[model samples]
Target: MADAGYVLPDEELAQLQKLSSDFEPETTGPLVGERQSSAAITTEYANADPVYRVKTAALPSKYAYFRTCRGDGHCGWRAIAFTYLEALVREANVGKFEEEEARLMSINNLFNNVGINYELIIDFAEEMFDLLHKLAHSVSSNDGNADAILLQAFNDMGTSLSIITYIKFLASAWVQAHPADFEAFITTGDVKTYCSLSIEPSQCELDYVAVGALSAALIKPAGFAFEIMYLDRSAGEEVNATVFSQPTDQNGMLLPNPPTIRLLYRPGHYDILYKAEDFPPPVQQQPIQVALANPYNDSFIPSESSVDIMAMIPGMYSTSFGHRWPSVPYEFDASPTPQAQVTPVQPYTPTPASAAPVNTSRQDYMPVHASHQPNHSNTGRHGLHLEGPPVTLPIHSLPPPPVSIERGHLTLERGGPFRPSMYELEQINVPSFQTSIFKNSQYNTAHYMNPDFQPEAWSPDTEYGAGHKGKHKPPAQ
Candidate 1:
């Protein structure tokens, strides 16, 4: 027996055994197992892939342990994706979403210049953006709930692919925007050619050029810091590691306490690595029914701390909350089958938290109300309205478009459509092509899919008016 309550499932146990004896990408959570020492990795690789054994032998001291990701080409992107979510779970705030959203929005200029579409992946991009922000805003005492949300979102097939693919796309955009910076390193004729062959492919492991551009793009714009432990067969007694992010120019060191994401890189793969003893014990997920039984329960509520999308509703949220939605009191109607037991059948939508329509539309999905029902009486540009007395749902709750722009000739490659000799031909999780479908579709105003949506020109501070704003006439508000 493995351990009293820790018996691995038949398939999982088999995989673990295979991990020690073969070369395969880990296709699960980044921080799943306890941090394992480099010695353990070496021993595991002893009977497995000879290359891994050679690599593990060179890990530096700081990289004594690791969390390995699957080696299926996209490990680098997946590693970053996992780290971002884990950071959010750790923060548990909702408002964190809006900040991230805006940061990403600000980068539309960079991406537009790189020749990618902001339309196809926009919905997924926004959800992930909001997801992280909300987690930062949520202040749940039970962090396990936060952990569950992070894990669930990443594991969801649609989310997993959309997010990982987007990260890959972002890295590609960065490369295209700054081709001159990466020109010397690329083997292909141009950045676009290299990207078609490597970066955009879901399963292509990141190369040196991709790593630099992606590190700069993700770290600077997202405003997060990171350090990666490199365990390769290079000449080293322990795992080699390095920090990548915004550092002060004078002394050249990372700022203090900026939500660091630790990752382990062993040649072809990357994975998340948690500090052995710092964070609190991980919270476990509770059963849905038990969670819903408590009206004040917060197990299912999406973190709304940062974005405050809920707050956009007249009385839903407030900034005063430390890390959670303020609890409101409400009574539940009692039925043979308690009304609290009704489960929602719809997937969570981040657009605006919508109420299940009671009439003909989605009539099957209904929340049992004590004295009030959702008066989606009015549908506005934002979200459906929830009129009447407010109900604090802890037990249960829940949570498209096209674009424009241009494109280029994409010849085929492995794992991607355009990479030359790198990624293999495969699937397109988040298409990077710019289709000409938006013939005056009003999305052009803010979206960068059109050439007209050019970013405002920036300038250095300069002396302008003799008479400043003190004498300026106020425009109508």
Candidate 2:
């Protein structure tokens, strides 16, 4: 038996032992408890993994406290659903549930409209909503035990798991509703199987689309933002955080706060995050980049860094699927709203040799079209680097896009994008080789090259004056 090869399906294991009946086995204490200083947890990881420690240290500064969700694979579902209920509690505490009540009941229709029978998921949905209704209903019923009851319900295996199940249902319906929005991401070409196996089950770890769908469903009726702070061992000095942010204006800058709720993600787990007054407000954002193809110079060489940036580029993105339709199942709607298409400013497509910067080693500036407007974030007290020209610095030469670190978690003052996904940079139907010379270059995969050999500071104003075209300026010595 010890020598036999075996792979136990996690789903089957759950059914056999009835495991998801409680929070993850290793999960710490009760469903909801008093918030603790994040440093308590961060300090534990500090010595062993500096990356996680430094990232975790910033957590307490931003969110004075956090509420943990048992890491038993259901944390994502519990984290969002729990926060939504707590939000309702606060509303009830202040005697405000009229609107919430109507919204709660209305969401039931989404379950049915998406072709899911309510009876199948009724037990869980009912238990979850009953506690939620009580949160708002306490105003009229005057139930003083709202907090106690809510906590008990969350801790209870039956009700807690039910609500989590409903969250998964909503995610499934979301996929069913907008096949186009998430279709490409669905490999194996089977959305239903993917949802059933990956999303709509207990203990299933959520992926990007699931997070997007779940956050959208939770926030739609309430008009709130759901931000997730990613705490992984990603390649960065600090943790990478993204938001299930609301749709942005043309410039891609999100409205301030907007009643935003934060979630902390640690690899496979998620927890609730709360903000306090003591944390320092993040300083200005980093410079924003947009698509603008310089048809002027074609002799410039694309750096290897651009290749990495290219890989990060993803197709079009949206805050919520089905044109931001509030939680309802869009598939059954009589008429869906028009798509709020994201007008990507990455407007540049390279032209021939004339469109490139000179042979200045790693500095191949791309002078894009006049309409190549980069987003202007308010963080830059020093105006956008794009004030004068339609030129873009080498994607690699510049700091990371959308986010640049200066103080704490700084969003680019030039353009702070809280977007959830990024795509590769390519024009419509452009042949692969045309985009980069390296695709067919004499270079092989074995060679190692370091672009940071002489990492120089760049200033668009000083580097690219009004008439500095085709003249590639080397880094300042």
Which 10 successive residues of model 2 have the least lDDT summed? 445-454
Report model 1's TM-score to 2 decimal places. Answer: 0.46
Error of 2 at 121 (Å): 1.6
| TM-score of each predicted structure versus truth | 0.46, 0.50
Candidate 2 TM-score to native: 0.50
lDDT of each: 0.44, 0.47
Steric overlap count per candidate: 50, 33
Predicted model with the maximum lDDT: 2
Stretches of candidate 2 off by over 4 Å are 1-28, 92-96, 139-145, 247-256, 277-477
Per-residue CA lDDT of model 2 for 1-477, tens digit only, reads 343344346546867678556534555555654444443344334333435534553344345446667666777788788777776664544433556556656777877887888789888777766776667666556666775677778878778888888888878888877778788888875787888888987768878878877776666456567788888877553456686757444576665555556788877767777765322233111221111112112312233443233224342112111111111101211112111222223222233431221111112222211111111111111112322332332221111111111111111111211121111223222443243322211111100111110011122223233332211222121
